[model samples]
Target: MASSTSLTLSQALLARATSLHQSSTDRVSLATFTGLKSSSTTTTTTPLLSSSRRAANRRCAALPGPARTRPGAVKAVSVETAVGQAADTALVEKSINTIRFLAIDAVEKANSGHPGLPMGCAPMGHVLYDEVMRYNPKNPYWFNRDRFVLSAGHGCMLQYALLHLAGYDSVQEEDLKSFRQWGSRTPGHPENFETPGVEVTTGPLGQGIANAVGLALAEKHLAARYNKPDNEIVDHYTYVILGDGCQMEGISNEACSLAGHWGLGKLIAFYDDNHISIDGDTEIAFTESVDKRFEGLGWHVIWVKNGNTGYDEIRAAIKEAKAVTDKPTLIKVTTTIGFGSPNKANSYSVHGSALGAKEVDATRKNLGWPFEPFHVPEDVKKHWSRHAPKGSALEAEWNAKFAEYEKKYKEEAAELKSIITGELPVGWEKALPTYTPESPADATRNLSQQCLNALAKVLPGFLGGSADLASSNMTLLKMFGDFQKDTPEERNVRFGVREHGMGAICNGIALHSPGGLIPYCATFFVFTDYMRAAIRISALSEAGVIYVMTHDSIGLGEDGPTHQPIEHIASFRAMPNILMLRPADGNETAGAYKVAVLNRKRPSILALSRQKLKQLPGTSIEGVEKGGYIISDNSSGNKPDVILIGTGSELEIAAQAAEELRKEGKAVRVVSFISWELFDEQSDAYKESVLPAAVSARVSIEAGSTFGWEKIIGSKGKAIGIDRFGASAPAGRIYKEYGLTAEAVIAAAKELS
Candidate 1:
């Protein structure tokens, strides 16, 4: 049956070629060949030269018709002719070889990089960079530029090569030479901060693919919100190149499935089917048919017989993929690893290590190339350089359209301009909801919800959603619409159950959104482990994404230790550019939101309590902004004998304990330390004034671990916190059982005194 099918496909291709080649204007009638083959066949007739002009055509015409030959033999000859013709691209052929050579030279220069991908998948990357992608080399952050992600980030050489050839400012010759070195624009992986053309930081196997989904999501949302009936302003596609390693990683599956569910038509992934992995052939572990799996996930799947020699086919497939308006497309392009390399082709040896001087010379000779190191033919460089202006022209056109849009819709235009500039709306924090001391006790999450609602009313750019816990996480803004699959105007997002994807997507949205939109994502604090890498990237890139995490500690009842967060606070605090704020009450929660919105240079995580607490008199917005402050004064005045410091729900306990200690004749001061990271950033005079060094005796109270608190509490001080995991019970009961009461704080304070 396979043989018969092949013969029939060959005959159909020959017939289509005859019809297309004879037609002028390079346009052919695709409908005339209908029913000549199976519907799966994407056969289109295009003009080809006479049989005398091509050796392959003469050979093909001389062969006997399909009916007179063995089926397998007929199919093989026809496929060879078709592949030969597909590979014959004056523009793309030279560009593909350039990509491969540049990749080889760059990696050889760096002495560290995975070279197999750049050499093997050069055709795919070449087609994408030269003909398929749309972006501005002059302005890498062009809001409507197509996003390209290298999901198999070990193949950074491939992306760097394309960026250099395409003329992005981030990848100069010096940067290429300095690859993997400290402070170089070209890092080992595609880091957005390090490279201009890079959309997200990707080195971990599966992150880039998931980040692409986020970028696609952002495009859809912006298109929905801003595009007019005539002005399709916010439309752009996201393209990703993935390999065996990316598919094997679980995060890829998680993101791909979610993208399929959302039916993101703007997302197109090209899977490089090289078969070889770092250890050897992929059959050692990954054996599933990747194309079928993606099809099962509701993606439009296309298979290219030979990616290395089928540049036109890959290009055609990508064009056809763009027409798929209902679902994202995944094209599996079968490629030989280290193509054109005589000694290392199809082997794992070429995956990481440099091809060595001798082998490199041999590979160049095999490909009929010159021997000079880092050599590039002038003609080839000129061919790729033609694409440089295409992106700039595209951006210029978009800018003209934007100018017209601004005239018609001034407010929306200004809003979008603010987002583009990464600026917050003026006086955006003035509307932050404030709570008085007499206000009723409420969970911090509820306070957060109120804050979100207030901000959403005043700040149209505040967009986010919770990870399948919107109701519980209290991340929803009633004033704004929900960002559903089709509803782009919705400000609030419903990320469903995909936590990792949500976090990465939030990063993309935050990075790509015009300066004003503060993109955020939420989930239980314990589940942040799933999205830690993405969160770290947001911090590293300084994307300013707010992470709202609830169910902060053992105070979360009955869900047990699995749901409770023990090390989450400390873990987040350790991240370099992230601000971790655990607010104590409603007012402080409002303050945290205010700070998060105003912060443009750093990302923030607002840790909120699931349980309600009294609106304390000391929980002032001004005091919270200082990161930490003396909320209560000592009765003895001149200097406190002991200082009680605490955060979140424990602050109330510390305040109560300080009152008790003062009554017992020990001068006591209570400090509301909302953010340890922020407190540490304050000047020594400010920190000493808040917690005077004269008062060496100090008691630090919190619900979590005491790992990093010693630095703040000092040698003579102690921390009153749960050193173990939490249990499943009522929050009040758990707090008492864990000795988190005011009595425990007072005892610790006395001991320190």
Candidate 2:
């Protein structure tokens, strides 16, 4: 690690490129570190991978393809030289140029996208894909393949070009041409749902790095659980390329802090230190010593001064990063933003805009490239084509290794297989505890804890924690120990006071294995503001992360307005592709867990209460599944004098209101609108059965914003909610002061009737 090798420096010296002196000690000879295969057995030694793994890599040089070379080939390098000496400076330059132009040309064609990053970071991109990273482009979902995140996602062309060169079918020539277009696999940013090779949806700066931490954490946890000393199965690395913007975002610091604390050694992040943001040089607004900051954050910091062309420096940095086993590494690669463009190379003009036709011509002339747009020099193609076969062979070797491991460790293999392939146990839902009307009253957050512990017992991949609110949120998995640097296999993750990082990290965990790893994160409901971007990404990227938000409303009390989420539920309700669930009792809490577990492609937010409430009659696990169902009804013929609807802590109030109304000889139907999203998905007949369209006298009560309730309550109906901020008082007092009570519901219902 750089910290161990380098001398202690004063604050003044910390601003200097610290890794330059430290990197010299770690650089291996090109012969030993090169990506190319050596004819000389002595030169074939690679310190990065195990010798047994290297032996398994001895396979076909290329997949089956036509023998003849195409036009405009980089004839300077022969097929043998190109494949065998892929690390040769001249050949490597041509490959790097290919990546640069792919970005340049794609951006030129689209008339959009930030091109500076791809242009500057091409060397690192080329080295990673061509030399260092272990991935199967053809099988992007291969279980053991290394994960890569382009955290500076605006520079997605960098990733798109790499995917194209590495031979991902998702980014064929046509897809690159159709970049940023509707329905194109190559979107403006890397959306994992849109592109196969792209790992996570990361346009919002800082999120990808946070996600990378989660990915590394997942690797560490799984490795600890499944990797036997004799037969290691869960082993991989997570690499990320983040820019200055990511560093500027506070979320990155929060996540990186945790990454260092957790000692995610397998995570190596490449900080593209181009020093230029959209506004101009980062010095204009951001001039902090990032290396010093990261060092303080407990990361091994490395700096490659010549990122534009220092291929060996980048390689050496990566090699050194892998050697550091106690903490994550940050390789700061400083380079000119637009490396090759003569007129705009270091200027902000090239940060986002396309270098127009004349400059493109100048760039081409300068780089000595005459090929047409999207053209890959045949030598580069042939050189990169080896990865497909090599990747297949790697997966094959791993599969065989797993087969043997499975023979000896059947039970462990079954559990691991479930983690790899998203298959739940035969009756996983049955493991969720059920509660009857006779059950004691409890806070939904407490009920949620019961569900989480139960789920952890049955579901092998079920694991998560809170944003330093495990005690308040009641999200601790009682049976499991805290997941720390030493105890990686524990189900409980102590995320500290980092709500944004916690949310994004959980997104990464959920997306890591799709349906396999069901990661849940918890915090107070009001704190969603701190992590809305991450939660939104979870919705957009189809990450099934369960957000356990306690202190749902004014019911939390004393903490006052800032701590109470008046609009949180309504806001999440408006967001598409998310289930905003507010359970009233134990049965509904169990149902929320089931819904969260089953909806493997959609994220769920369970807004739980800090205050306890009674387990009301007619509130069932089955009724909660419908999102909204008649919990108590004295009405007949699907026609009631008034319909009372509520959620979370207020459902008991609505039930009480309904009882009072029913006593006055008025037909009342009390509906538990547990999840509006789920209820909207229910059949029209079922919806009508719960809240008949003919009945206009509907009264909806909730301790949230009255914003979107009009959609549920008809024109003649009323919504009783706290439109203003809550007061600092006892929970009961706050509820009474805010009129969030059965009396309010009864008044609204009678007025509507």
**TM-score of each candidate?**
0.87, 0.89
| Candidate 1 worst ten-residue window by lDDT | 50-59
* Candidate 1: segments with Cα more than 4 A from true spot: 1-91, 635-638
For candidate 1, write residues 265-336 as lDDT tens digits: 999998887778889887778778676688778787766555666555676677567667778888777677
Q: Global CA lDDT of candidate 1, please?
A: 0.74
Q: lDDT values of the candidates?
A: 0.74, 0.82
User: What tens digits encode model 2's per-residue C-alpha lDDT throughout 1-753?
Assistant: 112111111111211211211222121111111122213211221233110100111111011111122232111111121211345677888999999999999999999988889988888899788877776665667678899999999999999999989877668899889998877778999988777778899999999999999899999999999989899988899999999999999999999999999999999999987767889777778867787788889898776655766666677677667778888988877667878888888778999899999999989988888999999999899989988777655655566667667778889888887776677899988988888778888999999999999999999999999999999999999899999999999999999989999999999998778788999999999999999999999999889999999999988888988898998898999999999999999999999999999988899999998888898888888887899998888878888899998998888999888888888999999899999999999999888888888999999899999998999997788999989888888999988877888888888887878
Q: Which candidate should be chosen as best, given TM-score against the real structure?
A: 2
